[model samples]
Target: MASSSTPSVRDHASGRLKRAASTLAEDTQSLVSEIKKAFTMVKNIAVDLEREKESTKVKELETLAVQLSESCDNCIRHASAIHTVGNEYQPTSELTDFKKLLDEQFMKLKAMPSQNDRLIRQFQEAVWNVHHKGQPMPGEEEEDIVMTSTQSNLLNVKCPLSGKMITDLAEPVRSMDCKHIYEKEAVIAYLPRNGNKKQCCIAGCPKFLQAHRLVCDPFLLTEIDELRSMNQQTEQAQNVEDFTGLDDED
Candidate 1:
């Protein structure tokens, strides 16, 4: 009976060992799954950080591009104005600095897009305004007898041949050549007529008598000649109207 009890105790001990081994296997599997989940989380965080870094870089580049473009535009405009003035009045020390600034800005702008048109147009207008504004009035220069501020100011004034005043003087006197002068206000009124070419209204002025002085104002004379030719052609056509009533004898 004692031998029989020993065998039963051994069997129970073996069964308990088996159950512990199964529990160990399950814990090992759980540990492996947890490690995999942690690795996945770390990978996702790394990816997000990379994307954020790239997005920040793009924004910075965009800002830099805009600043570069504006700087270039301003440089071009300033340089053009300075160059125009320099051409007419000789270059100064300030102009040299201006040109250097313009070159630096233009080099930077060349890296940007869509700046060419704006640059060209700005330069063109600046140069044109500087060169053409208040140019010599196209007409005959006459020595005028005039009184000004308690003194007689003899002026070599050029009067507009298309019946217009060139200067805005107070109480202007008319020339015998049909060049009528009034206050400067009169000149403003005459600007629209004949595209601002002041016409000489003097009766004996060659402008009205002979078409020579009339044609002196290039743009105005062109329009006047066109209108005259059109009138002549229309009158000739009207005179050629057919009179078939006398053909009844045929």
Candidate 2:
């Protein structure tokens, strides 16, 4: 005797499962930070008694935290697979083959490196639609809005104010208003010239540069790291080529 509210309860449970998975993922990533804090406390205790800091213990704790974090990540993946199936799909003998195939595909997805970006985006859009109903979900870009040239390429971009390259070391940040990037220190120094909010340094740019609009460009930092790796590889190749050329001359 199933009640009329059974479907509603199932839907609610699905939402809760998704939320719990998200929270668990966040907590797992933060575990390293918590370990660092605990080690700091341990060091403080050692200082009080004038004893040597337990560096070896700290390393063991960090290793344990990393292993636990990996386990939690696997748990999140399993939970996500269950949430994706929903409550409507009942396992029957007729659907056994289909269920097996579905599970295999999920396992493959778990092993895929790009699964994080693709699956997370899909799940976020699905969750937004489920909760928001009639409202349109925000996307990467809008149809009506035109992106500026600065927004097109984030790599090796220059700070408009200082005429210097913006990299991770420069503390790069992006403007939420114009999607333009800047060296964080340069932008901060430029803003006070015209009383808090200054016009963007790029010529003909209409957006005002304010402290609140500038957010840390994490993607830019990642790109910078990749670029540095590429440059190092190129330099090594050139050195090898030069050495080979000298040997040929001999």
Candidate 3:
């Protein structure tokens, strides 16, 4: 039996496991934040072809973010299990030290650069496939190919419910159902809070809208900004041409 003041081996192991899980969760969250920041930067570049490539890279980053999030959830689950088992069951002589195992695995994960390499390889392969029309040279192995966005799936920036442009809305969200965007508050108001389904605001659309289906679309918001910037520049150039002709006439 353990002394009253001192923790038993089971209790000590449980505490160590909890700390390991907590550290993993925090670090995972920090990595997610960094990914978001990098995503924003990638979206801000002006060239169209470059933007397309960056978009592919961003998708890969998003996948990595999702994986890291799942890993964090698993860590939390494992920590909870450790707490439960430590409290209820007797600590056996051959009981696994999950803390040591997690620490070893976490250190290995941190040391591995294969994940980063894979992302870069996929990004490069996407760019190559785009340029080459997905045909590989005679000796090379086949790589995964990504298709460009088709015209029919593109979403208009204007909100279907309020007729407000994406740039004008304080918070814009996209519907995963019909690929339509809406002003977040407007759409929320349009749908009943009681969880009743509502028809999509856009005419001729068959999909139903629910609160869960609405997602924050940073990519759409970025596209809207790019479009607005291009339009402004075109108008400014036209104004310059008109002013030049007026001066010549004078």
Ranked by lDDT, top first: 3, 2, 1
> What lDDT, from 0 to 1, does candidate 1 have?
0.36
Candidate 3, residue 249: Cα displacement in angstroms equals 4.3
lDDT of 2: 0.51
lDDT per residue as tens, model 1, 1-250 = 9777876775665455434433443343344344334433433443344345554543444344344444444443333333322222322223245456446544543453433333232222223334343232234122211111112111213344333333323333332234333333344454454454444443444532212112111112222323344356456645654444445545
Q: Considering summed lDDT, which 10 consecutive residues are worst modelled in model 1?
A: 144-153
**Every model's TM-score:** 0.20, 0.35, 0.39
Error of 3 at 14 (Å): 25
Whole-model lDDT per candidate: 0.36, 0.51, 0.55
User: Per-residue alpha-carbon lDDT of model 3 for 126-243, expressed as tens digits?
Assistant: 4444547447633564542222211112366678888887768888777756878889999999999899889988888898998866755323443454456545745876899999
Model 1 off-target regions past 4 Å?
52-250
Clashes of 3: 0
Query: If both were scored by lDDT, which would come out higher, candidate 1 or candidate 2?
Result: 2
What's the ranking of the predictions by TM-score, best on top? 3, 2, 1
Indicate which candidate wins on TM-score.
Answer: 3
All predictions: root-mean-square deviation over Cα? 43.5, 21.1, 14.3
Clashes (backbone N, CA, C under 3 Å), per candidate, total: 12, 0, 0
